[model samples]
Target: MEHKILGVIGGMGPKATSVFFDKVVEKTEAHKDQDHIDMVILNHATIPDRTSVILEKNEKMFITAIKKDIELLEAAKVDHIAIPCNTSHYFYEDLQKMTDIDIIHMVDETVKKIVETYGANCKVGIMATSGTISSGIYDKSATKFNIDLSVPNQTLQDQIMKIIYNDIKNDLTADTNEIEAIIHDFIFKQNCSCVILACTEFSCIKLSEEIQSYCIDAMDVLVERSIELSGKQLKSLQQNKSNAAII
Candidate 1:
């Protein structure tokens, strides 16, 4: 098979980008270095915080900067582009328009994965930043897949944001016990079939064994698709799931 190069538009949060890259390498079924997919990663960490831009309604600044990244990836002649940040996907359509190369739609693919795994009627819960929830990107994708979507209430949403920014982004340890409590509420109270960890920052935190069955990391979904799209084989499911194992 002719393998293709994967282009990563990263550094939305430096740690999460590193985690995504590490997951890709860990989850690819490769025995030697030569079997791995070739990659081009542009760590555009200086790009404006996605949540802030969306909340402040300053789309132009983010768009202007990301457009350049797209052009650079195109010039690099990559077969596909993957943006690991969930909130940045709020500009998915516009960014897709800027280049001929396909930019993997993390939100859309995540919704599709839910439908495929749990069935279309499964009630889904999203744990993402306020901007992602407000932008309605996951909601729109869920609607298309006929999957019902739910989100944390305001108080919990604020907690999620703080965990992403104040904790993980600041290089502090995430309170996984608190995070798991929220996940339990989604499952037992809100009746969510499975929760989608839609933020890349969450990808950097290892999930507990109890909630792993009830959650799907959107970043993991993106990593899997990126490998497949690059024409590389996926590691066995049991092995691939280890990358997101116990916090």
Candidate 2:
């Protein structure tokens, strides 16, 4: 069987990109080294910050950088691409137009999972970069899925931004206490059924047991979809190895 090459357009923040790639490797149902899916990762760390571009309304540099990455992946002959950064999906449509390669929609996939797991009435709280929230990418997906979405207020949003940029992005320890309090507010105050870690940087934070119960990491969803699209079985499916083989 011919397998598709999975392309990762990453390094929006270097650590998040690393985590996504690690999940891909860890979640593949591979018995040997060769059983793993074929992948090409373009860790283009030099790409300008998505939040800065979106907020400033000057997207030329960002667009140019992303287009170059896509071109590099296209030249590599990757069949599909996945971008791990939630904020960057604001340009997903435009990016798709620049290449023939298929790009997986992370926000759409994440929203679908919410609907599938909790039904249309589910209220999901979003933890993402200000750019992602302002871009309304998740909002659009929530509307499409007919699910209610909640976001932090301006004050809380600023704190979240600091955790993402000042802490996680800069290799400092994340403030788990603050994150937990936010999650608590989302669940108890906002009446959210679950929270989506829409920012890749949030993936770097260790979720406390209470928060872990209700939080969904968007990066994990993207990793799963990437594996599926690449023609590889999920590691979880290996529990039924014989059945998986038959399929």
Candidate 3:
């Protein structure tokens, strides 16, 4: 059987990309290696932190790094590609013009699913990087999909920033008490139906089964997409089976 290959442009946070791949495998309904999608992961950790450079006004370096990886994936001739970072999507138009390959939009895809599964006008909390918030990626996507977005107050946004950058990325969760409390306030007290873990770094969290009851982690949503788009489904190949030996 011919295998369909997927090219993943990852390593925006380095580890988030790795975890996303693991999720593709875990979510695949396939029962064997042959049933999985073939993929090439360009774990280009050298790429600068996308959110930092965007929020900090440093651009050329990240643009160059991303272009190099996109070129590599194009050379590999993979069927589809996706970057798991939401904030980095501000650069999607630039990348799209640069490559012929399909670039799946995490922001767009996640919003479509959220509305279809959640509702058309439900209130949602966003827990993305400052850059993601600043760029208005989620807000735009949500508006396009007709979901109302409510953001935490500035003080709470700061607390979220610390938990994502300082706590998760820096391995300083023990000292993130202030941020954890803020998360609780945004979800429980605010009556947010769902909170989008808009930053990929938040994927490293161990969501309290309590939080899991309401919020959907962003990375997990991307992985589910990777699996669905992988072209590995037996149902996808059913038409080709008509040529099989007569039974």
By TM-score, who's the top model here?
Answer: 1
lDDT per residue (tens digit) for residues 1-247 in model 2 = 4679999999888889998988788788889999898889999899999999999997788999888889889899999999999999999888989988889999999999999999997899999999999999999999999999997899999999998888889875788988888888899998999999999888777777678788888998999999999988888745544553554
Q: What is the lDDT of candidate 3?
A: 0.76
lDDT tens string, model 3, 38-111?
88998887778777788788877788889988888888998778888888898888888888888888888888
* Per-candidate RMSD, Å: 1.9, 4.2, 7.1
Specify the poorest-scoring 10-residue window by lDDT in model 1.
238-247
Residue 94, model 1, lDDT: 90
Candidate 1 stretches with Cα past 4 Å from truth are: 241-247
Model 1 C-alpha lDDT per residue in residues 1-247, reported as the tens digit of each score: 6799999999988888999999899989999999999999999989998988999999999999988888888899999999999999999989988888999999999999999999988999899999999999998998899999997889999999899899999985799998888899999999999999999888887767889889989999999999999999999988766654642
TM-score of each model, paired residue for residue = 0.96, 0.93, 0.87
* Candidate 2, superposed: residue stretches over 4 Å from native: 237-247
